[model samples]
Structures are given as structure tokens and as C-alpha cells.
Target chain A: MSSTRSGGRSAIVRARVLAAASDLVTTKGPQNVTIPEIAQRAGVAASSLYRRWGDVGALLLEMAAERLAQKFPLPDEGSIEGDLRCWTEKIVLGLNSTEEPIFFRILLAAGDVAPEKRIKALAPRREQLQAMLERGRARGERTPTVEDLVDHLLAPLYMRALVGLPVNEALAKHLVERLLNTPP
Target chain B: MSSTRSGGRSAIVRARVLAAASDLVTTKGPQNVTIPEIAQRAGVAASSLYRRWGDVGALLLEMAAERLAQKFPLPDEGSIEGDLRCWTEKIVLGLNSTEEPIFFRILLAAGDVAPEKRIKALAPRREQLQAMLERGRARGERTPTVEDLVDHLLAPLYMRALVGLPVNEALAKHLVERLLNTPP
Candidate 1:
């Protein structure tokens, strides 16, 4: 059989590859990172790396999925506003994190290229927020149609957080406050 | 001296380059488009293209700046809500246009990578909006701070336009009406 780098070693190798890929994306920008360079940094043959993942695109997509998973928190706050504030703050903080800046930059770049993936990738986050909003509705603390809330409240917070500047703690607070207080 | 293509031919070549770049960005994604490919598509030599612009970054930046200049119309409607509605509809229509999807997408991508440049490049559009809001304030139609209006009204419209799903025309109208009616 081919050398089975299974269990612990395999996990270690995967982490190394992911770390190398992340670092490259952060430093050089996503479009500029080459697979051979990633392989070299991971200390694996380029062929071996390719065998593990079909292509750099597949690898990067998986990397983005993993990064997004880390960034999203399951909303547990009792109030809709509290949950939204938590959610918004989490996303803003994630966008500003030094470690994931390149990952997010690449995600934005990829979203521009293939909007389908972005729509699909956002499903989980949307669902999570929707669930929280439903709970809030049941509790009589939120509006019945969370989608309206999404359009009015969350959208602006997202745009400012993503496009304007690096979302700092103060900006996150201001965004939360603005969203919470916007008229119906 | 080298063969210096003139006036009409120069303009044609420039248009070809821009069209090629835009097409490539839409089809293959912006990150995949190389300068060499653009030069070939434009029927101009790489050396000539290189001599004109130092690198791809400069070319992309100029393309972005030019695209913005074309899309952001002068707002002189004399009312803040009217001006905002005009701007929002125009931008959303631009975003949804099949011919220019990549324009909005690239602007979004560029914002993530080179944020400082993105911020600077976006200043003109904001300045125009701010100027209109200042007029509104002078006329007693708005608060002293234009940023509040931006956060509440304009930012959400843009977010909905860019985030994959088609923004509702009615929602856009409602947002502007809300902005016009809301108190500071």
C-alpha cells in the first residue's frame, strides 16, 4: 500500500498545509499564491499535495469553509437584538482579526469571482440568524418577519464592516447601536 | 523611434484592452486575467502595454476608477431623498446589469485587499452624497451629520444589491421613503 500517513500524522500534515496556504494568502494575496509554493512550505511533494486535494481551488474553498466555520458562532442570546449584536460583533471581530485577514480578503476575492459559492456559503449563517429571530418572535421581543430585520438592520452593519474600514471594537459597538435603534 | 500608434487607433486599442479586461474579469474571474492575455486580446504588444502602465495593479486600479466615474452620476435633484433614491436605483441597476457585474464584484474584491486604496477610490462617490446631504441640512431637511443617513439608508441598499440575491425595487423605494420621513 502507499505510505499511509494516517491518524495523527495525517492531521498534523493537513494543518501544516492549511497554515502554509493561509499564510501565503495573507502575505501575497490569494490570486498570487501558487500550489508549488504551498507544497514547499508544507514540506510535501507537490504531487502528493495534489493527490490529497484535486486542485488549489478545491483546497482554498475548503480552507475558506473552515475559516468561516471558525468565525461564525451559534447565536444563543435570548433577545433578537442581543443575538444580532452578538452575531455582528463576532463577524466584525473576525474581519479585523490579524490572523484571518488574508483568509477573509481571499474569500471576498473569491466571492467576486463566483457569487454562487458566496450565496451557498452564507446559508448556514443565515439559517443560524433566522433561528434566533424565530425564537425572539416566539418570545415577543422581535418582529415576525426576520427577513425585514435582515434587510434593514443587518445589511448596513455588514457593508460598513466589510467595505469601509477595519472593524474595530468601537465600530462594532456603534454598528450594533445603530442597528438596534433604526426605525421600522 | 518605436512605432507609436496614434489618436483613433490608440483609442480603439485602449477600448479593446478595457473590453478584454472586463470580459476576462466576468468570465474567468479577475484574478485569472493576466496582463499578457489582455495585451494579446487588445492586439497590442506586451512591451507597449508595459511601457504605458508599470504593472497589472496600476491597470486594475485605473479600470476601477474609470468604472466608478462612469457609474456614479452627478446628483442635483435638490432633495436628499430624491437624490438618494436616484443614486440607489442607479447603483443597483448598475450592479444587476449583465454587462457590468464584474465591475461591482471587482470593486468589492479590491475593497478587501487594498482597503486604503479602496477607501480613497470610493471617496468621490461619498463626497457627492455628503455634498447633497449638506444641502439638505442647510434646507432643514436633514441632521447636521450625513453619516447617520449613510449608515441607515444608503449602506443597506448597497449591501442588498451586492450580496447575491436581487434587491427588491419596492424595498429600495421604501428605504428611501423611510429615510425621508425619519427624524434625526
Candidate 2:
């Protein structure tokens, strides 16, 4: 095969491996998933898997980063409350999505075990939220401090996710309302 | 041994075993801990460990319940803000406690995988908070619903614990202030 074709094949292999790993993490808890099992599921050779990702943890971290990026698109609803509602509702929906909770729990556990990796994985997502907040502030909306955002907005969402609490649209709306209405 | 002495000895053994299990969970991530290792650390026979708890999950569940009970003692300082500040400061301290994060992550992961166990472990702790809120309500404080309490108070605390974020007195006080000031 030509060099270009080989490059395309390699990309396909990586995608398949990541997809298989994500599926395994969803079905079986991250603690239960093994590299061999992932390789088998991906129909990729073990050597190829190792060459690409080094280990299951690395692969899982990458998968988590990818998943997070996909899950949180920067919301632009023109007003702070509208944007927050749109963003938070998406978060609640993502949390409530079937199989997403398991995947999220695994990623969280991974973060707990590895702080540096956690920072790296979350930096981009945090930046996205930060930029969105800055935009709202520029628009003369009462944007909360980052600390407040984490405590009032993100933390509550995460806590519900971890505790298996229902994350409905109403809950999302209430959160935004409280945050926007509460005085600093 | 006499029957009374045997009962006393069994209780001691249970305590030792649990202590050792807690230590192991703190030192080694919960996934790395084994029953035999815990038994060895506790200076008990492997059979006794298995006979008492059956498996690691059961032991961890018991440990989580025990830890939760100890960490959150209901605070009644004559006013809602005082009580919340007192209670939340303790929670922040517990979250910032070295090794506590790992233990909490394990329990949270267990909760995610098994919802029934999560309810069993958290029910008493939730009740304590509920009772505290009801007392404040009787004192004419604007007590939030149980659902709101989870969203506004507990969720932020748990999120910080799981994510290795700083759970400080300032943060706790801020949380209480926001909760009290925000209209339900």
C-alpha cells in the first residue's frame, strides 16, 4: 500500500482501539478492564495497542479528554442565564445519558489517582468554560468568579453525577437561577 | 474462653480488621487492596476476614458508612448560618485530610457501580443533615428542600473532595452564605 494509505489505516486502527476501550469502560468498570481485553475487542494486535497508547490508563485518559471535549460545547445563548441554562442542561443530560455515568466515574477515579493527569485532562474544558464566562462578563452579565462557578455550578452537577441523583432540566434551570440571582 | 470473653474478642477482631482495611484503602487505592492483605495487616486469620465480611466490597461499604457517620455530626449552634459554617468547616477539613480523598473516591466509584449500596451508605448522613435543616426551619430560617440541600450544599463539597479541589473554611462559609441568602 502507498504511504498515504498506510497513514489512513493507522488512524483507523487508533480510532477502533479508542472506541473499543470506551465501550469496555462503559460496560465494565475501569478497574475491571484490561489491555488484552481492549485489544481483543478492537481487533488490534497487542503490540500495536502498546505502541500507540503505552497502557490502558493512558488510553483511558485520552478517551476521557475526547469524551469531555465532545460533551461540553461552548454555549452562546446571548445572555448569561440563557447560556448557563443551555450549558448546565447539556451537562445534566450528559450525566444522565446511559453508559455516560460509568465512563465519567472511571475518568473521575483516574483523576483522583493521578493529579497531574487530571489537570492536563481538564485544562482545555476549564478554558472553554472560562472563555464562555469572559464573554458573558463582556456582555455586562453578572458572571461569577471561577471559584464560585466551580462551587455553585460545576460541583453540584458533579456531586449529583457521582451520587446517582437525577440531573433533570429543571434542576439545571434552578441551578442557573440560583447562581444568577444570588449576590456575591 | 467464656462466651462473654469470646464476644469481646470477636468485637476486637472486627475493629482491628476494619482499621486495617481503612489503612490499606488509604495507602493503596481501593482497587489494589485484597482481603488477605487486610487480614494480615490486622493480624487476623484469612478465614475470619472472609467469614465476617465475605468480600472486599462489603468491607469497603461498611468502612464508608462508618467514615461518613464520624465525619458529619449534626451541628446546632443556635442559628442556621453558624450551624452550617460549623458543619461545612468540618466537611472541608475531612476533604482536605490527607488520604481521605482516595478513600472517598473508592466509595464514590462503588456508589456509581452499585446504587443500592450508595443509598444505604448515605441515608443516615442525609438524615442528619435533614434533621439539622428542620431544626433551623423551626427556628424560622428559610430551610431549603432536601433536594436543594443536596444541590447547594452537599454536591459542592463532594465535588471538591472527588476532584482534589481545595475545600477550605472560606469555601464552606461562602457556600453557606449563598445557600442562606438565595431564595428557594
> Which candidate leads in TM-score?
2
Separate DockQ for every predicted complex: 0.28, 0.35
Model 1 segments more than 4 A misplaced: A1-71, A101-121, A143-154, A161-163, B1-59, B111-114, B143-150
Pairs clashing within candidate 2: none
Worst 10 residues of 2 chain A by lDDT: A111-120
Q: What does candidate 1's lDDT look like per residue over B1-184, in tens digits?
A: 2345567677787778777776677677765677898898878898877776555544555575566667655577887777777767776666566664565556555543455655565566567667777888788875435555556665666665444555656767877776666555
Q: Candidate 2 residues A40-155, lDDT tens each? A: 99998888777766667767766766777676577888887777888888778777776445545655656434445555545666677788889889998779876667778887
- DockQ, model 2, C-alpha based: 0.35
lDDT (CA) per prediction: 0.64, 0.73
lDDT of 2 by residue, B38-139 (tens): 989999899877786666766776776677677656888988788888877877776766644554666664643455445555666668878888898899
Clashing pairs in 1: none
Query: In candidate 1 chain A, what residue range of length 10 has the lowest lDDT sum?
Result: A110-119
